[model samples]
Target chain A: MVSYVETTALRSPAMWFTANRLTTGLLLVILLILPFVAPRYWIYFAGLLGINIIATHGLNIMMGYTGLLSLGHAAFIGVGAYTAALAQIHLGLPFWIAIPLAGVMAAVIGVGFGLPSLRIRGLYLVIATLAAQFILNFVFVHWQSVTNGDVGLTVQPATIFGVSLNNETRIYYLILFAVVFMTWFVVNVIRSRVGRALIAVRERDLTAQVLGVEIVKYKLIAFALGSFYAGVAGGLLAYFNRFVNPEQFGLLLSVFFLSAVIVGGMGSTLGAILGAVFMTLLPELLREGALQVGDTFGFDIALILVPLRETVFGLLMVSFLILEPRGLAQLWKRAKQKFERR
Target chain B: MNFFIEYSIVGIASGGIYALIALGIIVIFKSSKTFNFAMGEMMMLSAYFFYAATVTYSLGLVAGFCVALAGSIAIALLIERVAIRPMLGRPFIAVVMVTFGIGSIIRGVVGMVWGPNDLQIPAILSRSPVMLGDIFIPGKTARAFAIAVVIVVGLIAYLRYSRAGVALRAAAADAITAYSMGIDVRRIIAFTWIIAAITGCISGVLMANVNTLTPHLGMVALNVLAVVILGGMNSIGGVLIAGFIIGWLEAVTGLMLGTEYREITPYILALMVLLVRPTGLFGTKEIERI
Candidate 1:
């Protein structure tokens, strides 16, 4: 019957730290043994889910926390992916250096786009970010010398200390490490003064400004930081896939990420994690479910499931918006409250 | 010079279609203040409906056109009633997300019904070229251009003169006040959606005839988005002009630069226009009170 706050804030720091350490250690052990326990295919999905989680976290910061809606978020991801790929291929930078460089590049672009939020907001900003997506996509497609255009660039395996992280298992471990570190950082950020400023800005910009919060500074920081996460996730994705293509980073992907933030519960870190996992597995789950139904009914439902899945996905967004505007995070909170009452 | 004129005409033809698409988007925005991201999907769906009527059902062109237009109208009404009506007091972004979802649903439905591959909806108009004193125009383009102009003019006149149009405009201006004045704001909103759907159908049919029909045809909405941004989101007549200007810009860019420039030019132009005048050339500037 413990309240949500009593369950967390009431706990002693030493006890909390011990619990955190135990959880972290257990998570690390589980991740290490996951490849041995689960199949290779699930491992790939897990890596992808991890990448989505990272990107969604950043998106949550911008859209969820700061109330800046970006329709071209995937462009930053592209910037990160391309930067890492190009850095590794042309400059021959190591994975460690290239990944951070990707984040920096995407952060730069994110800040550039964020500058307009100072002048415009609401729907105008959405269009502005959409413009960023299209422009960046155009560049990715046409800048043949750098991006290699439509043919796409095949990423070489990343290495560290003469050990190539070539296999999916190694990439999975790397993603796991990245996800844990990023999640920790994001959680810390949310609990910080800056995080409070971000929430204040999202709730009311005028009020936040009146309270001496530099709206522009915080907005730009949110964008840059969010995009940094996206860029890093993009780098991880590029390495894991061993390929980078302009086609992969489209407006649809941006919409998917935005949807994930919404579905998970905007502004909550846990919601981002949950949403990414749910959305990433959705199509696969739908396909399997459709196959089962097809087998049961003696009909080939698989042929139509792609469109059906899309329709259902759209329905989910609409229903969620109307029925659960606060998203799964809010739902989880409600469930926890019920449990506490019980 | 002749080549320039010809491409310009081609551009105008395509621009007219873009205007039609933008008209639908603007109409929806004017009434509800909701940007229907699904406008492109509506266009795509209506085009598929037209194809189904004419090709799949083997209906004649006249009957097929009616069925197609009617189907689009029905879909628009259904969407407004189901998804949009429930979203009245929601945040702007959430509503935008709903439209995005609607778009996905439409795309999925189209994919399921028609399959993912491109289907050629046979050109309803004659395929012969028209001679206009040293300029040659394709038959379908000429027909589409004419249809677009007629519809634009017709809609303008209707809005300026019709009782329903005046009520709709009033509702758009102040929904609460209009409701108090005994104007059925809800009906007006629904009518506006119908107009949007009609425009979607016309543009869809024209575009399908001009190009091969595919699930991705809705992506062209992005191009028309530049047109709407250029024309101003609320300015109906301005959208037409902006559409033509952008169409010409695309053509000129394609000629001077390369084929790739055509695809990206609209977005670049949209950005430039937005940075210079965020309200767009003819759009009403939204004033904020502190």
Candidate 2:
């Protein structure tokens, strides 16, 4: 399947530049106006969508770019979140300080988990990550001194220039800023020499090693980079929800992010954005659909919708892997090509 | 001393059930070269089938067992035909994700039909506790253990002597060679799945009898995963040993420390084992010829 990258490569640079400018300008205009135009609750979801976008971008770097599968990504996110929350509560640190520190904490833990990748690959590595997930989750629950156990921890909102960014619109811009910055950062990273090394490692480590690339360093860097994004996203999530809990960062959440990366287009920035938005909106869409069906059928089907949504999500993941492994990014590329042909 | 003996016995019993489930997983992995992430979900489906038969339909225990077995076999066969069969020759991730999808679908369907509430399956065994010189064992646990052991033994024997079993082994060793030899590798893979579903179903019911049936019963896959990884994914003997080791560790740890520690300990053990020996004990170290 053709990706946007390939399609853009095929077109003239001048036209490609104009198209890129137009799309970015349009997207920026839309994003700026969305909080004002959309319902308040929808803005909240948009904030969540942006947070997930950042997290999915991180996952894409490892799974999509580096060909490393982590079933324990949520654990890293949890570490970032708990670290951020605990820092705020115990250390009495400001949100700005706590958030970056959370990212560092998650990155350190991520590198520790990445050590197993050096010894194992494929399914074995997956299990090692799974181990990280469980062990970290256990700590989150059992280490009550900081985490507060099942009761969960509340996160104080951030402040910038003595202005409390507590409202949904404020958080929306904060997350949007992070999302744009991280997306730009990742795009640059992918184009750089390190990104090339990562892609090379992904294709075949033996071949990459023969070519004089440092496989271990790049792999760990991918982990650190990915988890760093997760950490920042987690901090944002805690802020958005105003609460942090272990349950939110379970294996299911990790699976969701992994699925988003796969379903979006693994190695593409566009894919991450598309996948995250689709996944974030999917449940809400399902809830609405279920509500409509219930209204039409005269039944209280709301209780079943959550599980049904989960099933549909799973089904979508399978179908995408089977029929369109390149994900929605590829699909968008194809549509654009068709339009050009027309 | 008696308390220790009792927990050990209970551990062994639960371990037997774990072995039973792990057997199904190993069986599928052996023939298909794919891990069945849906194994636990398949077991949950079986438990639901039993609940539907005995509780919903008021069928007796025997009927419930038959229905559960049949239901799981059907689900497994359908999965193989629809999902696994198409996934052949595709990327390994596709197969893995398909199983994950299958699992999600099973959970969703089960939740829709049964709702989220926990349902209890009446104890299949007589309620009397067994007293062996001051060490008491619950009858249900003992019976479940015994049944699981019997099934494991029967399966090992089947794999050893049966013609279909030999064909499965041949297919597992080299699918292309077995196919060229006219062994019908596809049929063998399908048969393996059927066997796995049956074993998984029985184990699920047995465990559900021990603990009431819930839609979340599939979460037991995590613990069983530790058992499989520790024992070696490819070895039935290793799985059995590992299962008992983990089960006893869990019981002992839960008794000695807080119950919460039991959940993460197996994963930690698995991580340690994978770090030290990626191939696992008794697992053949895969060599890449290229």
Best by TM-score: 2
Residue A340 accuracy (lDDT) in model 1: 79
Mark the regions of model 1 whose C-alpha exceeds 4 Å error after superposition: A1-29, A295-305, B287-290
Question: Candidate 2 at B205: error in angstroms?
Answer: 1.1
Each candidate's B-chain TM-score, in sequence, is 0.96, 0.95
Give the per-residue lDDT of model 2 (tens digit) for B1-290: 77888888787778888888888998898998888989999998899899999989999999889988998999899999988887787655557777877888888888888899889887787768888788898998888888988998899789878999889889888999999999998888899899988888998898898888988898788688888888887776687788788888888887778788888878887878766776667778662222
- Per-residue CA lDDT of model 2 for A315-334, tens digit only, reads 88877877787789889878
Compute the lDDT of residue A329 as modeled in candidate 1: 71
- Checking candidate 1 for backbone clashes, the offending pairs are none
lDDT of 2: 0.83
Clashing residue pairs, backbone N/CA/C < 3 A, model 2: none
Kindly report the fnat of each predicted structure, to 2 decimals: 0.63, 0.54
Docking quality level of the chain pair in candidate 2? acceptable
RMSD of each: 3.7, 2.7
Candidate 2: residue B71 lDDT (0-100): 87
Calculate model 2's interface RMSD in Å.
4.0
Q: lDDT tens digits, residues A250-326, model 1? A: 98789788888888877777778878988898889889998998899899786798788788788778887777766
